[model samples]
Target: MANKIILTGGGSAGHVTVNIALLPELTKRGWNMVYIGSEDGIERELMTPYTNVPYYAIKTGKLRRYFDWKNFKDPFKVITGAYQAYDIIRKEKPQVVFSKGGFVSVPVVIGAWLNRTPIIIHESDVTPGLANRIAIPFATKVCTTFEETSAHVPSQKVEYIGAVIREELLQGSAIKGRNTLFFTRSKPTLLVMGGSLGSKRLNEVIRDSLPLLLQEFHIIHICGKGQVDETLTHQAYRQFEYVTDELPDFLATADLIISRAGSNAIFEFLTLQKPMILIPLPTSSSRGDQIVNAASFQKNGYAEVIPDEQVTKDRLVQTVHQVYEQRSIYMGNMQKVKKRDPLLAIIQLIEKTALSDRSRNKKEK
Candidate 1:
């Protein structure tokens, strides 16, 4: 019988992309893959293109740090989700469950543990998010993109595999990207992105700085959904609510990037050797994971960082010029870092864990 695996994660693009990256390879190896996620989530939309992979939706409540009225009611929803997940796992009888950290993953992990199924979860940030932290004890192995994360989680379960970049991203064509955007080769191209939901502050600052920036470079701004300013249009400026298929091309064409300090995104930029200016989400709005991610990248000479609170029109323009000027230095530092095949590493671990589970089951029988 073929090895079967249940994949779970959602709530944001970051939680889903790693699992997306794993799909092609797992499919090629003849693994039967199923996905369990929230009923309505970005994961559902992103996974729609994969007809072969069966998708199961379950109820999930947002795992929030701050207190809210919903806090009282969410535990019941989570309990329902856990029961639903347990039923699915019982029926599917997968050898292992692989999770990318998100709110939906908690119940799935709990279910997997209840079924005595081995579980593996990936953590992309410097520290485990609330979802991952809750699921860690149940996981057979916890893969991390940052080595420093070991101190925060169970050291025995931690596997520092580094970033698992999507294969397609490395195949992007700069020429194709430039042609699609009608961008010329004479000027540098600056790509700005503020994560999946988009950053209001980033959108406002970038729009405000466009006039000065457009003089030096062609700009592609992924301003997030419903964040576009329809009133302002420029010959050298292009705005997108989001880009799915065209993202690789855009990355290829970019000479420099100004983006939020999400770990997965920054690692992709680093892999592509794109110099960056990072604006981490402020601690007030977040648990400050992005701030730590940005600081790590800056320390490694891979990027520059501006605190979210300090981002201004003038500051953004100045940083753009500074990063563009020092682009080679940043690229050089990125090149100096040794590369590892994290995708393969994670796959090997999954296969190993699955085989062990199968062996133990057989021995007991």
Candidate 2:
């Protein structure tokens, strides 16, 4: 029988992208993959393209740090989701459960534990997110993109696997990207990504500084869904709510990137050798994981950091020019770093853990 695995993660695109990266490889290896996620999340939409993978949606509650009226109600939702996840795990009988940390993953991890399935969790940020922290006790192995994250996780469970970038991202065509966007090769291209949902501050600043920016470069702005401004269409500026299949091409075309410091996105930028300016989410908004991620990248000389609160029209414009001027230095620093096959490492770990569990079960029998 072929090995079967359950993949779970959601809430944001960051939580889901790693699992998406894993799908092709898992499928190629003949693993039967099932995805468990929230009833109506970006995960479901992202997984919709994979007709072969069975997607299971469960009810999940937001794991918030701050108190809200819903706080009292959400635990019950989490309990219900746990029950649903348990039922699905029992029915699917996957040998292993692989989770990318998000609130939706907690119940699934609990369910996998209840089912005596080996659970492997992937943490993308320099620090584990709340969901990963909650799930860590149940995980057989916790894979980390940043080596520094090992200090936060249980020492025995942590595996420093680095980033698992999507394979297609490395295959982007700059010529194809320019032709598709109708951008001229005469000017450098600037790609602004605020992540999957988009960044309101990034959108506002980029738009505000467009006149000055467009003079030097062609701009591709991936403003979040419904955030597109129809009024400000410039010849050198193109706006997209999001891109899926064409993302690789866009990444290929970008000479410089201005983005929020999501671990997955920034790591993808690093893998592609793109010089970037990172504006992390402020502590008031998030648990400040992005701040840590940005700092790490900056320390490695892979990126320039801009605190979210300090983002302004003049600062953004000036920073863009400075980063572009010193782009080669950043690229040189990135190229100096040795690359590892993290996807393969994680996959092998999953297989080894599952096999070990099976062997132990047989021995007990």
Candidate 3:
């Protein structure tokens, strides 16, 4: 019989990318998989086409951290999500639930708990988010991408697993050959990304500074497709509005990267052993989680953090220059951080949990 499994969480690529990184391993191991996500999320578009697995979407929204009148409605949504999840759990009866923390996962986690399903939650950031923090109490096994997360979690149940980066990142090709569009002067190339929907603020900063940056180094910017138009094409930038599958080629070519401090992107760079410049979204961000994440990586020397106030043209140029001049320092510090083949670890965890569930079932029978 198939060992049933369900995966949840999707507000950003940080939450969705974990499943992408692990799907190959799950498929190779022949485990049956189901996905639980929000109806309006990118997961429905990304995961459904790739896997022939059961996927269910729940109605969900984030509860504001600050006082807002709309905050009153969140409790009702939580109740509605729980009911939706209850139906999914009853129909699928998954043996184990793996969640990447997000608002959408709250309902699934609660429903799984009520059904007595084994729960595993993975926090991909240096700190746990609100959903994962709440879910930690009930999670049978809690996994984290960063060691520092244990402090805020207040749970002895947590396990520190290196970030589960997409498998391709771990096996990146060695830096070699002449400078390409993404690299110039064989001086490390820095990749700047703002996530799938893209960051207008980051894009504007890059636009302001790119004219100077291009003279000294090569850059490959993943300007979100939504931002692409005749106006940007006229800019003197070697950029990609869209390149889905060849993303590995771009990363393999980069020597350094400038990116937002999304846990998924940061870990991807870590896995590739590339130096990073992280700009957490400013204080006014909707979630305010990226600022905390960026600071944690900076504290540990995994990357350097540049506050939005200091993201001027001069600062951007100076920061890139400083890191390039001291390339060895950044690369050396990154070594202290861990990198591994997460495919094996995920497979082992799933198989172990699945077998344990089957054994318990036999005993009950």
Candidate 4:
């Protein structure tokens, strides 16, 4: 019988992308896989077309960070979702569960714990989310994208693996050093990204600051779907709503990047070893995690953080010029850092854990 493995997580690309990078390797190793995600989240939409692996979606709603009277029902919803997840796990009897935490994954984590299943969870930010924080005690192993994340959780439960960004990024990092996407002059290329939807604030700042950058550098802007039609008619900006296949090509070619400090994007920038100017979303971010992630990246010397309230055309221009002027120094700083081979590490972890579980079952038989 083939070894079966169950993977669960979603709500955003930050959580779901971890699974995207790992799934292909699991399939290559001949493991039967099933993906568990929230019915209404982005995961089911993103993963369904790519694989035949069965997907089970449970009804889930996001829990607000701030206290509201409506918060009273959260535990009840979690309990219901947990029972649903428990039923799914019992039917599949997979060897192990790998969860990337979000509110949607809470029930699944609880179910895995209740069922005596071995569980591994990945935390992508310097600060762990409430779901991951709660699930840490039940996890067989906890992997973190930042060293700081462990400070908030028990040290013994964490492994600092760096963020597991998508495999396409690793492919983007292979060669071309600082010149892949839009190389005009020997001057650095600047790649702009604002989450999956693009950032109106960052776009506005960049739009205002474009003339100054255009004189010295090439710009590849992922305006995201929302701003694709926005009037960014600047001669210097090469904008796209989405470049699904060419994103890696753009990153590989960039010398510098202007982007939001999303966990997945920041890790990709570091892995590529490029200098970046980060504009983190407001403290009121939907997930309330981007602020911490931006601050953490600044502390680590990987990037410069520009808070949303402080981001302006002049500041954006000045910071871009400052980083460019000191390119050699910043690039050297990035080179001093070590990066994980996300694909190899994730693939090994899943294959080894699944095989081990299979071996134990065989012994029992």
Segments in model 1 whose C-alpha atoms lie over 4 Å from true places:
none
Per-residue lDDT tens digits for candidate 2, residues 227-255, read: 99999988889999998889999999999
Determine which window of 10 residues in candidate 4 has minimal summed lDDT: 173-182
- Give the number of the best model, judged by lDDT: 1
Q: List the residue pairs that clash in candidate 1.
A: none
Models sorted by lDDT, best on top: 1, 2, 4, 3
- Screening candidate 3 with a backbone cut-off below 3 angstroms (N, C-alpha, C), the clashing residue pairs are 190-256, 191-257
Give candidate 1's whole-model lDDT.
0.94
In order of appearance, the predictions have TM-scores of: 0.99, 0.99, 0.90, 0.88
lDDT of 3 at 144: 74
Candidate 3 runs further than 4 Å off: 170-188, 233-236, 241-243, 286-288, 336-339
- Model 4 scores a C-alpha lDDT of 0.79
Write down the RMSD of candidate 4 (Cα, Å): 3.0
Report the lDDT tens digits of candidate 4 across residue range 241-316. 7666677877877778888888988878887788888888887765657888877778767788888999888888
**Superior by TM-score: candidate 3 or candidate 4:** 3
The sequence of per-residue lDDT tens digits that candidate 1 reaches over residues 1-365 is 99999999998899999999999999999999999999999999999999999999999888889989999998888899999999999999999999998999999999999999999999999988999989998999999999899898787898999999999999999999999999999899999999999999999999888889989999999999999899988878899999999999999999999999988999999999999999999989999999999999999999999999999999889989999999999999999989899999999999999999989999999
Lowest-lDDT window of 10 residues in candidate 3? 174-183
TM-score for candidate 3: 0.90
